[model samples]
Target: MLLLWILLILYAIFLAPGSGRDEIFHALIRGDFADVEPLVVTIFSFLGVFPLLFAAILLPDRRSGSWPFVLLSMGTGAFSLLPYFYLRGRFKGLEKIVTPVWLMRVASSRSFIGIIVALFILSLLPLTGGISLNAYKDAFMHSSLVSVMTVDFLILVPLSWYAMKRFRGIPSPISFIPIIGPALLLWQQRGEKDNERTE
Candidate 1:
């Protein structure tokens, strides 16, 4: 997630200001999409990744004083995740907050995974002649919605892999596949079928 933020910063420095792409960047930042091409702005603006992220952040709630971290996350991405690492020994109460089977189930659900994968794919749809590479670059570089979506997607990609490895213990290669990865991870989480086969 820090890498995502770093890349976003680099994009802002190189692609979001002064001549060339600067004007486009400004328009996108201001939500002035009248000049942006195709569904690039439209689709990215509506993806629900932020809400998903917020829900996860809020899971620990005031009991652990984790809500402020969610606000911090809104501004700093993975830096906001620091509270979790920082409070590791400070509190174990969060375990009760996070131990619900149903919540994990929801996170691992096919629909949730599909929405995430679809958001990533839709974010890339401009690659097919919808806009110039530079145009896409500037939009991502400056558009608030686009930057947020990209960061969340980047975070989710690695996070999903980590969850699968740590919890599901599936073969390494399975997590490398796109849509199938999240599906299989959640499926294993959902029942004993995979565990039975493995045993």
Candidate 2:
């Protein structure tokens, strides 16, 4: 994890300034970047996906008030990933933490995973939609919201995915089937490790 932190800090120092939280905030609240893109408002809405899905994955074995951190992550970006790392030591490992009754109810629902999956598809639709996809390609090259969402998507989702894999003790390497894998893990009532513990 030391190498991960080093790379994180270095990347933030060098690359984040160009497409950091402040830019996302300004573009979101005031339409600061309206003239530059296919659509800034649409981008702003989709931007929240990184945090929302991330929170859903992390909340199962964690305490209450995780929602606020998820809300904050929209502008704070990587700041959200910090708190959970601190909590990992406290609970002896996230997998073994005490899951709340309410959280279990939420996690056990297959429909919830379906919803998250649908939203994910909807979220990326703008970027992946034909002409817009080509436009996003240009923006990605020049570094617009493409860069911001790309960085946030890269950072948060994989972190959540790794945590899920470790928590579930999934040795399958490809534990998740790409888009819905994390959602499935999040929605799991009793994961592989959970089942082992129960037995």
Candidate 3:
């Protein structure tokens, strides 16, 4: 998770003012899609890391029942597992091997269920191509400085703070700032699970 945040934060920093890519996107939003093509190609960078990060964290697990939704969430929103996987791997011996039954169950978890619903709703948005595409194109072009920051905050904060805390285990400002929130959240969740088992 730290690694994930480092890369994302680095990318975000580069997007600050005077950055080439920032200027380029600015141009694209201003009805300069033709010029943005070469730059838009850079989106593949995010796409590449997306799948690897998702698979690394998602491929291993042992929670029982309804696991497919977990997988659906990973494939659609790969970063979700960053916290949980790192923490769990640390305490539980990586080679212990999560059972198939458990994996299915986690995939079907209530939390995961809600994510699936959101993903499906987002899929219906017209951003990919056609009229909706124009809407996104317009927003990026006309959006205010505050709007962009809001987007960045939404992406960076939840994953680093709340999601990390709820799903992974965030303990302090250091780890939280570093995007190790996932690892922190995982530690807490595992402890809770253990306590439940004991009870």
Q: TM-score for every candidate vs. truth?
A: 0.47, 0.58, 0.28
| lDDT (Cα, tens digit) per residue for candidate 2, span 12-91 | 55664344344444554564544445443345454555565555555554553354455577676555665655456565
After superposition, the stretches of candidate 2 with alpha carbons farther than 4 Å from their true spots are 2-10, 16-47, 62-71, 74-77, 90-104, 131-146, 171-179, 185-199
lDDT by residue (tens digit), candidate 3, 41-103 = 223122223232222224434431113423553333334344344455365543454447554
Q: Global CA lDDT of candidate 3, please?
A: 0.39
Off by over 4 Å in 1: 1-90, 98-131, 144-152, 171-180, 188-199
In terms of lDDT, the poorest run of 10 residues in model 1 is 53-62
Taking every candidate in turn, the Cα RMSD to the unseen true structure, in Å, is 6.8, 5.9, 14.7
Candidate 1 lDDT over residue span 51-165, tens digit each: 3433332332334344444456545554455445455457777544443455544544446656655665665555455556576566666565455545554654555455346
Model 1 gets an lDDT of 0.50
Question: Best candidate per TM-score, number?
Answer: 2
Backbone clashes, each candidate: 0, 0, 23
Please report, in order, the local distance difference test score of every candidate based on alpha carbons: 0.50, 0.55, 0.39
